[model samples]
Target: MSTTYFISDHHFGHKNIIDFENRPFSDVDEMTSNMIAKWNAVVRKEDKIFHLGDFSFLNKERTQEIVSQLNGYKILILGNHDRGRPRTWWLEAGFDEVSEYPLIYMNFFFLSHEPMYMNKQMPYLNVHGHIHGQKYEGRHYYNVSVEQLDYTPVSFEQIRDSVVVDEEQA
Candidate 1:
């Protein structure tokens, strides 16, 4: 069976992101290769991956080149930087699907590029990216930013099993 994975903020070809985020790579090439290996180490061809966004700062061809190396059927939700390009651009850049806004998955999880205002009073748990190193302090928030995830995609089941939100909130 195919697993569903989540990851974000690759920021490929964006050199300053290395310094800004304290990523452990010398250059964009190294970062891209390392990320590809890490992503494919767990994800497979049949798997699905939700990339919450900020995927790259490269040109479309370069972006497609990097995307081609990764495993899984990729889906992207637009992030702040990603807004510069149209959905068609991301699709051409090799994502299988793209969403301009947040999506609800598995009925109760709110999937977004930016963390939304989620509380126990709300039924949905927010799974998001955008804030690379900083995190929201609550069981209601899950950050899948690459910085938090060792540059590898995490399984949806892993995210689901790790949280214990109140069902009464529904």
Candidate 2:
């Protein structure tokens, strides 16, 4: 089976990223290109990528240009920043699905953005983006990277192992 990856909160074209988070790139164009490169480096053409949200800072046209360069079947989980774009815009941008809640595969829970609280009772591993790899406690969460917002996608097995390691150390 092909591997599936999850990433989110690219915020491409957002000039404020530099001041807000001290992103390395001087401009959005540089950030966008670098993100695309980082993603293609790890993802195969046949792999599926699930982007949680905040794909762009400008509009759909700019977003589409960046999206076109990336490989894989893409999906979007709409976030606060993605609000107001037409539904057709996302459909045309080659997203297989756009949703607000969790997308599941083989009992793993995937979302573009992180939820306030994860449900431990569910036989699900939550994958999300929003926080930028800061301090947070959860069963499973993937923090966004400025270099490549939605570039790397990890498996449930990988996440489980990481969580187990964290628990053991605790």
Candidate 3:
């Protein structure tokens, strides 16, 4: 079976992230290329990838180009940065789904951008990007790595197992 992968906050073509996140890339092109390479390394043609949001920077053309290079059946969870663009752009890019809220699977919740306040009462574990490294404290969240996420989508089973282990220890 094909693997499912999840990733977010690539911010391709955005040089500001270097200063903001202390990323090592010197320019936007370098950052975009590196992110593509990292994604291609683990992604296969048959994989399914969910991009949480902030997929690109500045222009839609650049975003389209970068998204085209990645291999997968892509699904987009729209982020705040994706505003102003028509839905057609994402639809044409091969994204199976596009929404502002989280997508739920099994007992987990998938969000492209971070929630202002995670719903701690929910049984679902939240997987999201945007904050980079802020801990979730009592709630469950996954901070996916861009360098390693590639095209492979994270599995619900893997997330459940990790949460189970963490909860057991707590």
Candidate 4:
């Protein structure tokens, strides 16, 4: 079975991100290589991965090259930095799909590059990125920032299990 996964904020080709995020790479090349390896380690070619944005700092040609080396059907939800390019550009650069706004999935997960404002009365969970290592304070929110992950794409099953566990503890 091909699984669905989510991840964000790779910032490929951005050198300052190393010091900014305190990422463990000496430079951009090392960062890209390591992150790509981590991504492929858990995601298979047939799996679907929703990248919630800030994908890269590289130009289209370089981004396409990086995207082609990865495994899975990729979808990008444009983040702040990513919006500088037209949606069509991202598609041409190898993403299977690209969105300018948030997407609702499985009728419950609200996926976006930035967290949407929600309340306890709302009936959906917000899965988002852009905040890097920080996270919001609610069960209704899930941050998929690479800093919040094992530097690998997170499967839907994994998110579901985490929600279930948190609910049980609540």
Checking candidate 3 for backbone clashes, the offending pairs are: 4-153, 5-152, 5-153, 5-154, 6-153, 39-150
| Residue 163 Cα positional deviation in candidate 1, in Å, after optimal superposition | 0.2
Candidate 3 residue spans exceeding 4 A from truth: 145-157
Scored by lDDT, the top model is: 4
Question: Per-residue CA lDDT of candidate 2, range 1-170, in tens?
Answer: 66777777788888897567667788877877777888888778788877878777766676777777888888888877776776567877667777765666565554547654656565455566676646356555545443334345554456567767866886
| TM-score of every candidate relative to the true structure | 0.95, 0.82, 0.84, 0.98
State the lDDT of candidate 1 residue by residue for 49-163, as single tens digits: 9999999999999999999999999999999999999999999999999999999999988999999997567757899999999999867889999999999899988888777
Cα lDDT, all candidates:
0.92, 0.68, 0.69, 0.94
Error of 4 at 128 (Å): 0.3
Error of 1 at 131 (Å): 0.5
Error of 1 at 45 (Å): 0.1
Task: Judge candidate 3 at residue 12 and give its lDDT.
Answer: 73
lDDT measured at residue 31 in model 3 versus the true structure, 0 to 100 = 79
Better of 3 and 4 by TM-score: 4
